[model samples]
Target: MTTISQTAGYTDLQTALKVRARNPALDRLRCFLTLVVLLHHSVIAYTYFGHTDPKSWIGFDAIILSTDSFFMATFFFLSGLFIWPSLAHKEPWIFLRDRLLRLGLPLAIAALTIIPIAYYAIALRRAPHISFADFWWTTVTVGPWPSGPVWFISVLLAFDLAASTLHRLSPKLVDPINRLSLRGYERPAVFFVFMLIVTAIVYIPARVYFGASRWFEFGPLSLQSSRVLLYPVYFFIGAGVGAANFDRGLLSADGRLAKSNWAWIIAAMIPYCLLWVLIYMKREILGNPVWLPDWYEIIYGLLFAAFSAAILFAILAYFLRFKRLGSSMLDPMQAAAYGMFLVHDPIVLWLQYWLFDVDMPAIAKALIVFVLTVLLSWGATAALLKIPGATRVL
Candidate 1:
């Protein structure tokens, strides 16, 4: 008995629901995080200890310290959101197909192309006579092949495949987490505690054993040895939150999280300062030992986990508070964020390489490089997206 008009109306409602499901706040946050990624890379060549350039900046160390701590974890968490819904909406094969195209394609391309180009700039510094072609060939064939920032894409693809398998086996496996998320709508602190505890449990022991600087790599596939489990913990937590009632769940803009973002920010700073204390302990007390003791790593890992968890909450709470206010400035760059992430490494490195001998303060060089990188990366992404059907993948 359904009339054609009624059917069309129902379909429109479905479309509207789909639109509503996309969280603009998180989109803007992700875009902002992409810029943070840029800043992290842009400033590293200028940091005091890693002063490859003639000039070095102390302030960049503080910037690097903060960004290196929380940005990747935040990326994983943001990525995990909407995955469950993606699984729920698509067939297993379709989900895999889309993920491979979206995540895997870019990863494969970046590994062979973008990453090599980025690192070649560094290779030029080490051996000014080395050609990019030779450097890239040796890197890929012999050893120390790096994936660079695209490691996230590969890891994300793995998480996506795992999620699809879990969805097939039992969609309800995450039901308990979904339940917890419902409670989180009213008290986001509960979710914050959950995230902190889980990350700490997974991160501390591994960090103590492997050390923070240790990375496990085979070819272009690489990740921090200490954080293998930590990333997935955040992803699954995000999955659980998005399993049902997204707006009514943990990230609810109208909920307690947004209402009291200042508290979460305060919570974030305590552990952040604690991390600096541990740094001081390492340098001043331990005399910058070549090898840190297990006790030191354990304490450092605890502070790292706590700071990461708190900052995740703080960032989300701030965004949720502004979610419905109006059009975000980030909207323009949102589509370009992924492209910016994929392509920025080479841009920053090449810029830094060009600025290597420039007679300027470290801060000035960093500012110039950072600004140009942002502009060029954004322009490159915008141009690429204009190609025939490029939007389908990049």
Candidate 2:
């Protein structure tokens, strides 16, 4: 029943989707997020809430709060954007193999090697004389096996597995979301509101029940309890957006979503400011309770969810708006970004440990750590990529 013209249209759409899938804008965004991750860790030690050294800055607390609210969730969304297309192209077994090789292998390798090395700096601060062997044994064998940032990797692999199973059962499961994405082409605010509601629904209850600081942890496997469902919401929504017709959907470079960057910036700033107001209330008005009331948790959670959604849209729009200007500063690190993410924790940690005793102001120490961590991690990733057959995994 298909006409020649119809077939041609379909083919053209497919080609466009392929091009969009490989969009430089998305790559640049991922690289920017990676840098944000580095910046986040670089400054956390200096934050008022998490001060591990003599110097502490309230400014870093604001930065941490904003970054923590959005970055990992956005990373999951980006990871999901490519999943359905990848699955459509490869055999199930091949897809599984690739996911395992890329995600599983890194997780296993990092948990054993990189994680212990990074945590050793923290351990050294406490015991100062504790041997690496002793620290490693206690960490791996005894308890509190910290995964650092690679928890995201482990959880992502699990989501990929779940997605594979769902795809096998019904490829159309996400069709409704894809349809909504198409609608987003004209009215991105609709899509934004949808994501805000969904993320808030999933995130708020768990946050109120589990509180913010709780993590479900077991020997190198850990996740923030509240985010367990929140991340999957973002991931599956991204999958829906990317399920098909990626080039023509909400993220189309020419779409209103791209043109509406400023709207989202305003949207993001409102909730972000409100979040700080709540923070002030928690500390100044509520006496900084050990556990905030459920009402406080609910309101904070909603604001966090709103801010996250708006910022995601804003960042995506910013990139898409400038996507045609061609190669970016972020381009140079595109290939190495993943490797940089995997390896940056230890570099940042050790750099902080070295700078811990320095008499510099908090901002000075943080900048020194941030600049050095970026250079070192980039160099480390570049060197790693030179290894034979490393590109496939890195």
Candidate 3:
């Protein structure tokens, strides 16, 4: 028979293990990305290059360009970082059930309610008297259902399932990448180059084939054609890094990757500038043709992939380096971040709709939208978490 002291020791050990499983740096990084998502949508309507609002600014164009280039791919990579470990610990059925609750439930709910409400703001711009009843009915029953940002949730769930299946089939498949991650602790640039090459291989041909504006869509499911494979490449690379010896791998706090943050920033800037150069060539030199040439697409795609990979390393390095610097504004919002992401689109779109005629500068309107969206969405998530058993899904 076990003594009470022994049982208590066992319980404490289990608690410590659970706490150790959670990474503080990654948590804060995730929170920061959630805020980025809000800011991206809030200012997108005001970008001078793709202005949807009465007021527009070139600065917002730069902001959107960087965020659009890497944020979603980074999100998928961050998500993949824990997949192998998760599948190792949980029973397959248990893993699936939890993923369904966390991802699938939010996806279904958001697609049916939040997404329609959000897009309706745009619909009203086109047709002022369109009733919500008519719009919702047509959106679900007929055609043109958009998933909004919740498409990330649906796609992430699919990737998780595929990863689990792959893991069960051949546990050692990601061993090569894991080995590279271990080596990255000493020479981070090698890992960086590897990711750049892989992403370019998967993304360039697709960009040339799809021409950058096409999306594969069905009801509430949609993915950008050029990026459909790029995301999974990041996903699996992340999985490989976390597959084994995670604490000793590329992202280790003491690793060269974290120590060399400035280098990654420079790496990111070069390709980003080249990207703008390509944009200039398209508009001024190439006359903004309906279809850009294959040579142009190939060059643009390679630069985009390089920028994406470099920026990801830069961000992870920054977070890992300063991870021990104690509490942050981001800490308080970390738990609420996912809920905020799910709920913010409607709040932001509605705010933009209301502010359309406010007679303000582009920056001022964007500022107002961003601040209010953060506050309202954070408050809404807090309230939603108060409902009985809501925390499980949220």
Candidate 4:
């Protein structure tokens, strides 16, 4: 009996290790991406191009540009990874209920309260005498309700409903995508090319017509017009890839994606450089035209799509390659990452508001904001999770 107990203990330990081995890396990646989101917002007011605040820096412009180019779309891709397995296991109503609780609740809370408070900083700067209550009420009732980063949650819920319908219509709809994913094990570039083409085709026309800087903002629903179709494409592709035999697909440790990490790095750099060239052309050659020609938008849009795809490929490849390594800093922070994302925006904005009067360079101010935002966001998330049943949704 003692010997059998020892065998059972060993079996449990092995089971635990096997479970953690595959999941930790992806969890770490999500945490890191959340931090990136914080950093992106912290630096935005200081970017030379935006110049909303006193401090301005060209480096911040580059940071914001690069980040905006890929982060949201990549987020959709990451969010898609577990959808297939989730749908396969849960009843449709059960899944819908969970999504509503997890996604809808947060979005509603953020849009109604947190987002208003965050944007209140901007409003105060614009009109110092306006009371918070008045601003909040008018904002909520009248017009221009900014969703901020919580926009992703609302959009994701929509995608989940759409994907649910597709699954119900034909469970085998993703079979071809799974086959495409199988090819990625040896030739990951095939998947990369397919993603690039689809996004470019879907995105370029919308970008050219609507132009960049325009968002369909009405109440809590808002998204970049160009990315509406593009984001869904990436999400659906991710679902298809994860639909079957996930471990043997592109994310597999032994796949060409892991082996070609350096190649993907090079791939990411080329389009990034191309984007800068186009920027130079816009500033110098086009004389910074307010109304850009369709040809320029088409070319720039195509390059943007390529850059976006390559960077995602580069990030995924690098992560896959190092997934077998020991634990990372992101491991300890993983639990709070989602909460951090939900809360960080307001923290960063408030900090910026307080610091606006201080004498400091853009880089220094941005650094301080990023550091404080991270610590405060993490602490807030931890504290919130201690509430009875808060952890279930948060």
Candidate 5:
């Protein structure tokens, strides 16, 4: 039987042949995750900090946290999984070039077009006196403005650069990591323990000291960091798993693997739901604690991370089981996922401004903005992708 890699236009002949199926299930998973991200950011825009009334209650803040983290974690993991097969066979320069086109170009476009537009909307809402010239100057020439979700691209690039450096310095490191990952696949318990330990060791100090800021002032280096250590660890884990062909049964449909995946997913949700409730209670009753202890943050964060991974993987596995489900209509929406990531912030910001004067409940206003942003983002992305060169990365 011909494998996926043998399919025309499916495999890169120039790269090492790591034969894996395209798995439409995974593509659908990506599309769903992107929507989750859109929802999370849309909620953020309509919440108090952006434009919603301070007393307004959106009922979505709690759900947003889990969705954002899980969506991003899955995105990074999938990215890492794709990387190893490409890097293992391709020349280093070629690999870097492809990454640059895919990640860097989108970032540049976001910074110039999407981010500035979002800032303009924000300025109009918060300070109507601000002129177009001033807003453009502030967004473009000034300091690092929060470019909404495009921050993920910057962080991912940083991680990729670090990985590249390691590869350059210690060429033998990749082989050993791959071997270790293969061994861990055989012993799932050990792999889980290692992941937990690594999460604690790397995340604890970073979170406590860094305080969740993306841009850190570390002398000349000016460390652009976010998610502390969580993202890099997940990215590397993905690469390792890909290299070693460690399936984790996430794509498997039959027998023990399927059963185990479902069981673990349900088990994982217990802790996730509990932690979320605890967090809500702590905020509501105890009042926001001024300083969270390192131990508490580490434990809670690690638990959330694990639960998020389990939930996402299980969902993917279950969906993959139904082969006919992949026949759904493909739209420009699939191509627009990246563009939406870039453009949605502006769309949301603008929508929030327009909805500000409307006398509606917070939940109602949020829903309105959410729907509007989705439509606007979809439209904008479609238009952007039609332009020359823009379609390449987005």
Candidate 6:
């Protein structure tokens, strides 16, 4: 018979082992990314409420671009990082089932519950005369027109499903992609050139013909198309990194490579920030429609994206190096961040409509909305996590 204290000690040790198995750095990254998403949505809310002109709001515009494209790219990459190992370790059917339960269920819930609320709110505010049936029909058949942020969930589910199918058919295909490397003197330059060409080819045509809005549209029940070909690239990159055991050397305190990695990150940001400023100036000065020439947008967009990715990875690397900061109370908030992402837009829209008549500066109104939305969204997610089905998807 084991003593009670001994059993308690064994349980504690088991818990510690379980946590050590998972990546704390990834948890921190998730938390930071959630804040990025929050900031992005806050700025968009400000724009929606006519607090600032879309053209002139340089900081806000930069945040929007970085958040919309870069963060999602990173998310996919991180997802891919974890996914390949899990897939390689588990049976195919089990992996598929888990993906469906995790990705598919959330998507179904978003479409059925969250999106309908968005449409209802919009209809009430913008077109009150429209019946609920009309709103429902439009959302179901046409879309919530401009779909909410949860659009990422649906799109990612598609990617996962596709990747899983391919993996099942040809597990060998991923092996080569997983093995791609930059071994030569000019490899980094070659990689950059390849990325540039790919970005131009994908984004240029899409921007020139389809327009920016159309490129990101969520077509009813069929596809969520976008000019962002780099999402798949990021996912595969994550998979490759996992396959190669690419740990963040700089993230460790005693690591020798820290300084060089930090320098690379900072150097990357200079071009990114400059590109953002240039794009902001062009948009503000020219007052051109959002759908401008693909060439310029593609070039600048890629530059900004590279910068964003570098900065994000660097920040994570640095934080991971200093273990003291990793144990913050805010860590759980990161886990709750995805849930907040799914729900924040509807909350923002409702709050904006409710406060439309309030006498306040546009910035003040925006701040209020941001604070309230973050609190409410975080709380909603926290509560949902306690419920079994909600946690299953969330």
Cα lDDT tens digits, model 1, 150-217, are: 77777778888898999889988788888898899898888888878889999999988887777878
Estimate the lDDT of model 5: 0.59
lDDT of 2 by residue, 1-394 (tens): 0000001111111122442446778777877888888899999999877799899999999999888888888887887787777667768998788778877888899999998999999999999999999999998988679888887777888888999999989888999999999999998889998999999999999999999988888788788898879988988998899888887889899899999888899999999999999999999999999899999999999999999999999999998875687678888987778888889889989999999999999999999999999999999989999999888787
RMSD of each: 7.6, 7.3, 7.6, 8.2, 6.4, 8.6
Please state the error at residue 348 of candidate 4 in Å.
1.0
Per-residue lDDT over 1-394 for candidate 6, one digit per residue giving the tens place of the 0 to 100 score = 0000001111111122211255565566666666666666555645522343222243554556546545666676666655555655667787678667765676677767786776586578668788877887777776645445655665566666776776678665555444332221123333334444554565455545655455444453322244456566666655554443334322333333233456646756786777757666666875756656666666665565556456545554455554545486557675576677777777777777776677666567667777888899899989888997665556
Q: Tell me the lDDT of model 3 at 148.
A: 83
- Give the Å error, residue 354, model 3: 0.8
Alpha-carbon local distance difference test for all models: 0.79, 0.84, 0.83, 0.79, 0.59, 0.56
Off by over 4 Å in 4: 1-22
Better of 1 and 2 by lDDT: 2
Give candidate 5's error at residue 357 in angstroms: 1.6
Provide the TM-score for each candidate, comma-separated. 0.94, 0.95, 0.94, 0.93, 0.81, 0.78
Clashing pairs in 5: none
TM-score of 6: 0.78
Of 3 and 5, the candidate ahead on TM-score is 3
lDDT value for model 2:
0.84
- Could you tell which candidate, 2 or 6, scores higher by TM-score? 2
**After superposition, which runs of candidate 1 have C-alpha atoms over 4 Å from their true positions?**
1-20
Q: Write the per-residue lDDT of candidate 5 for residues 1-394, one digit (tens) a residue.
A: 0000000011111122446655555555555656676677666644432334432664565656556546666666666655556665667887688668766776777767777777687678678999877887775666445455666676667666676766667644555555655554334444555655665567656656654434553211233343556767777766665654445422334423334556657756876777777576557875867666666566566666566656655665565554446464433355666666667777777777777777777778777877887788789878877889876566
Clash count of each predicted structure: 0, 0, 0, 0, 0, 1
